[model samples]
Target chain A: MAQEFIQWLSHPGLNHFLIISGILFSFGIFAVLTRRNAILVLMGIELILNAANINFIAFSRYGTGTLDGQVIAIFVIILAAAEAAIALAIVLNIYQNFNTVNVDELNQLRD
Target chain B: MDLFTIVFYFLAIITLGAGAVVVFSRNIIHAAFALLFAFFGVAGLYVLLMADFIAITQLMIYVGGILVLVLFGVMLTSQVLDVQMKSGTIQTFPAVLVVSALAGTLVGIFWSTPWKTTAAAPMEVTAAKIGEMLLTSYLLPFEIASVVLLAALIGAALIARREKNA
Candidate 1:
């Protein structure tokens, strides 16, 4: 059993990549849920996007063996860039208008 | 272990450890810097997976372009940079519980499923193939991505510019 597990670790299969992506996704969610700063939240979103990208690349390499997944990943990266740009712009705007970047404290909109 | 396996393990550690720092670090600057390693590690993983073109693109667009913009955002929004920009966490316990459940479920699904895999050999060169596809089948998306980037550029500039009279 021990040698089998060691061999599996060395092989680094699809499940390995998927598990790592899962862990990354969990960390991203934790950051999004726990961080009050809007910029930090945006960072969390970036992490989530990256986790998904890893899965795409891994699947392309292992499962499909086509460039389709990589192509989709490229588009996803482009979207993430645009997202980070626009989201940060919005965060800066919030800071300018409200003098704070805390998502929780930006509650005047609710009222 | 063979060299490839060792390299894979190294890249995975770098990726996950740096990602951890990015999420858990209190100082914003530290987190941002740590993210550099995370991105680099991901790029290395792409290379190991034989997505050479995507790996280079990741390095250029992420490590070069996006990271620089993110640093600019950090500096521009914070006003003062001398003090530690300590961003605090909230609802930590509940977040832990929720994230644990989510991760467990995902890993369970990943392990239990019988994923279909092909034995196609990795290409020696992916850049030319990717380029051909981009100009051929992915032509519309290629153009659309450029347009989206242009719009984002204009919108970001408009929003972030200093309004002297507002």
Candidate 2:
């Protein structure tokens, strides 16, 4: 079993990419949930975007023809840029209104 | 092992390590820099996977564009007197449990799946072909992305300007 696992490890198989992307996505989720600062949350979102980008590139390389994977990756990049712009604007607004960018402190309407 | 496999493992390790840093770093600026490393590692993986166009786009967008935006946000909002705004205890146990479970499930799924290779290896499709498609068949989406960027630019400027007035 150990030898078989090593073989899989050394294989440039699609499974490796899938697993790596999944791990990255989870780390991003962890960052998003755990981080208090709004900027850190944005970074987490970027990480999540990258994880999706990895999946797209991997699929583009290994999957069937037609270049759909590349197309999807292009869209992901476009969306990420838009998201960053809008999110940063929101963060700046939060700073102006609340005097701090701590996401926890922005719960003014929670009560 | 073959060259491709060797390169894949190396890039994968780098990507994972940088990703871990992005999550675990306490300082927001440090996390942003670590994210740059992670993006570079992912681009490396893209190159290894023969997605040259995607690799270049990753480098251009994630490293060049998004990182700059993140750094600007970090610099603009950071407390100059108290740089250590990154707290220690936010969501500790739940994050650990969730991320660990996610990682385990992904590992299990990867191990269980059976992947088959193509009988004929993928042809060397050049970046020129990608450019050709971008200008031709995918022209609509490409044009749409440009308009979207323009809108984002105007929106960001508006938000920043609103602050100066208020």
Candidate 3:
């Protein structure tokens, strides 16, 4: 079993990409859930986007020999760029109003 | 053992390690900088997957554009290097528990699923095909994405601009 696992590791395949993307996605979730900084949360979202991109490219390369995945990945990248721009602008607005980027401290909407 | 596998593992480690730093780093500036490496590693992975156009796009757009904007935001904001630079976490235990469970499930699924695999082909130029598809089959989404980007640009400017009454 140990030798088989090592051999699997040595051959980087579709499953390898999938596993890596899964880990990245989980880390992104953890960051979004736990981090108090709004910017950090945005970073987490980027990570998640990247994880999805990896999956798309991997499947396109290993499963289907087409350019559809690459095209979609380009669109995803563009969307991620736009999202980061809007999110950073919003975060800056929040800082201007509340003087802090900590999500926990932005409880003014609370009763 | 092989060079291809070696490069892939190296890039993966860099990506994941930098990603971890981006998540758990206390200093926001450090995290922002660490994100640079993560993006680079991801781009490298894209190249290894034979998506050269996507890889270059990832490097240029992400490393050149978005990351610089993020760094600028960090620098322009008030007290970025002071005590407030420390990014704290809330409900760490519960978050870890949930994330770990989700990760386990995903890994199990990946291992069990019999994915469709084809013989590895030599890297070919994909820019032309991608461009052709964008203009033909994906024309609607392509145009919509541009519209969305325009809206985001205007929205960002509107929101970040200083109010006159203030």
Considering every candidate listed, which one attains the maximal lDDT?
A: 3
lDDT of 3 by residue, B41-61 (tens): 999999999999999999999
Candidate 2 lDDT at A71 equals 74
Best TM-score among the predictions, by candidate number: 3
Best of the two (2, 3) by TM-score: 3
Reported per model, the fraction of native interface contacts reproduced equals 0.67, 0.62, 0.80
State the TM-score for model 2.
0.91
* Model 2 chain B weakest 10-residue run by lDDT: B114-123
TM-score of each: 0.95, 0.91, 0.96
Worst 10 residues of 3 chain A by lDDT: A102-111
State the weakest 10-residue window (summed lDDT) of model 1 chain A.
A102-111
TM-score of chain A of each: 0.94, 0.92, 0.94
Give the docking tier of candidate 2.
medium
Candidate 1 has a DockQ of 0.72
Error of 2 at B126 (Å): 3.3
Docking class of 3: medium
Per-residue lDDT of B64-139 in model 2, one digit per residue for the tens?
9989998888887888568564645487898899889987998788668775544424657657777777889889
Prediction 2: B-chain TM-score: 0.85
What's the fnat for candidate 1, on a 0 to 1 scale?
A: 0.67
For A1-111, candidate 1 gives per-residue lDDT tens digits of 899888878887788888888888888898899998887887788889889999999999999888988998999999998998988888887788887888888987522
